[model samples]
Target: MAMIEDAGRRRALRTLTAGALAAGGGLLSVRAFAGGLATVNMQLGWVPGGNQVGEVVAKRLGYYEKEGIDFHIQPGGPNIDGVAIVASGRFQTGEISSSPSIMLAVSEGLPIKCIAVGLQQHPYTFFSLKKAPIRSPQDMIGKRIGIQSTGMVLLRALLAKHKIPENQVKIVPIGADMMPLVAGQVDAVTGWQTNTTALKPLGADRVDLRLWDTGVRLYALPYYATTSMLKEHPETVQGFLRATARGWMYANQNRDQAIDMLVKDYPNLNRADERVAIDSLMHYAFDQTTQTQGWGAMDAAVWEEQIAMYGQLGQFRAAQPKVDDVMTLDVLKATHSSRLKV
Candidate 1:
């Protein structure tokens, strides 16, 4: 589900407050704004870095301003509950690290829906050295696999998909460090392929086996907003998608300039590391589907597949959520023409 460091945090349901309600015609309602350009505060599930390069590009280039949006990004960390914060109507929108997070939240009655996907395929993968390679799910048998506690569900899903008994492999709970593999404490480690800085120590001998390749099929970097905001002000969501698409299209064409702007917006980011990371990030952002449907494209079939997989794994707390409960394509359809064509 959640791939970030604070994955253990409980996702308590937050009720919308009076401040979020607008009185219209003597009835309480949720409005995009009171007056002037609407502010779109995007809450993130993790600290901003290369993952937010497109939004950074849009903000820097005035794409959001051109769309009449006063855009701001609220950074998330271990202590932050971004999903609950947005569900409370304190923020207009949110972007999470994984797609199943939205499904799991919706299953628990969270008033959120995924509007668009940032990456076509998930980049989460298993890494091992060539000497002791885990080239496939079958290779994990009788081997020590180091993973984060929150990622245990993912590992379980992978094993289940392959029809391999869980007891055949040894799962070692480790932090985000790749040191366990380097020190021979574990035979393999799990992390995103886009994290070039962390993967640097693994060197050229590193072998990768993506979770998607194992038939897990999860999405990364999904954009979502509260259900009320979607029902009340779809146009605002459309505007955000249009501008954000332009930013990603621009980044795809102009890598060097995009990285320069990204590092400028977030001063702490190293230009060299991000420059290397963006190349890998773009591969997941755009693909054959993006080329035909434009940026931020998603397929309902994929969502259905994800729901079925997660349900079969017993990841849902209550009844399994429907695909419509977790996502919608209305905004994508409305902004199709405006989104940049790859």
Candidate 2:
């Protein structure tokens, strides 16, 4: 919750000096001063990192306006399930974790489809006490580990990959707080740097071993949408993606400026320790995931393997749907925000 220093402001001013206006500056004008606006409510996940950057950037740069999609950014809660919110029509646009969601929803007859994947690489890390003598994923065997929820995507993925049965290990739901690990209530915790950043104030110094580093080759955060949504208004969705794409590009291009804006706007955000959360996102950039597949593409093999894993874990009763059919590249390619090919 440290205040954004004046030096950060100077950095932002210097950064903006390079580009007076954003790439799609013209799209923001007109259709305002005014009434009759189409309302779009977007939901946020528990933490703000790579997943939240697109919406934050798009909102700041008016890329939503460029696409003619009026959006209102709504903060998500701790216990609120993102997929349930989206399925219930509580929000028009939002991001959610991939595993145990898309496939399960499709079988249950939900009209949701993954639009874009935000995290090319995941940020979830398994942390243990420095003196616990734990070094790697194998060390976690027969140990009680902490995670946010029982069905949390990362924890389940880790368990399945290690060939460790839940019966052998106790899974405790930490719910976005990792201080219990420091207090010895839990041996290791499942969380991102965002949660850990908040823990700095509590004097909990822990190391994170990025759990995805161990054999789990999968996509983490993917944007979802309903078929009915796309069919009713293709243009609006396309514009939203275009703006989202530009916002991501802008945010990546200008990190210091964006971080300054984020810390300044959300004063409760722990600024002193934000470097970990901020710098960890460097791995997710324009080229690796987005440019390779036009912002929201997933490999069929990866998707199928994930669903099959969910089935194996008994996370779902029946086989999941063909994810290749659920996710579409038509809209992203049509928008062509940049010259990237997928």
lDDT of 1 by residue, 127-231 (tens): 999999999999999999999987898998899888999999999989998999999999999999999999999999999999999998889999999898898
Per-model TM-score versus the true fold: 0.92, 0.75
What is candidate 1's local distance difference test score?
0.86
Best by TM-score: 1
RMSD of 2: 11.9
- Deviation from native of the Cα of residue 19 in model 2, angstroms: 46
lDDT per residue for candidate 2 within 94-132, as digits (tens), equals 676544456666655556677766666656667776667
In model 2, pairs of residues that clash are 1-270
Off by over 4 Å in 2: 1-38, 45-51, 78-82, 88-90, 151-157, 165-167, 170-175, 193-196, 199-207, 263-267, 273-276, 285-287, 336-342
Q: What are the Cα lDDT values of the candidates?
A: 0.86, 0.60
User: Residue 212 in candidate 1 has what lDDT?
Assistant: 91
Task: Name the 10 consecutive residues with the lowest summed lDDT in model 2.
Answer: 1-10
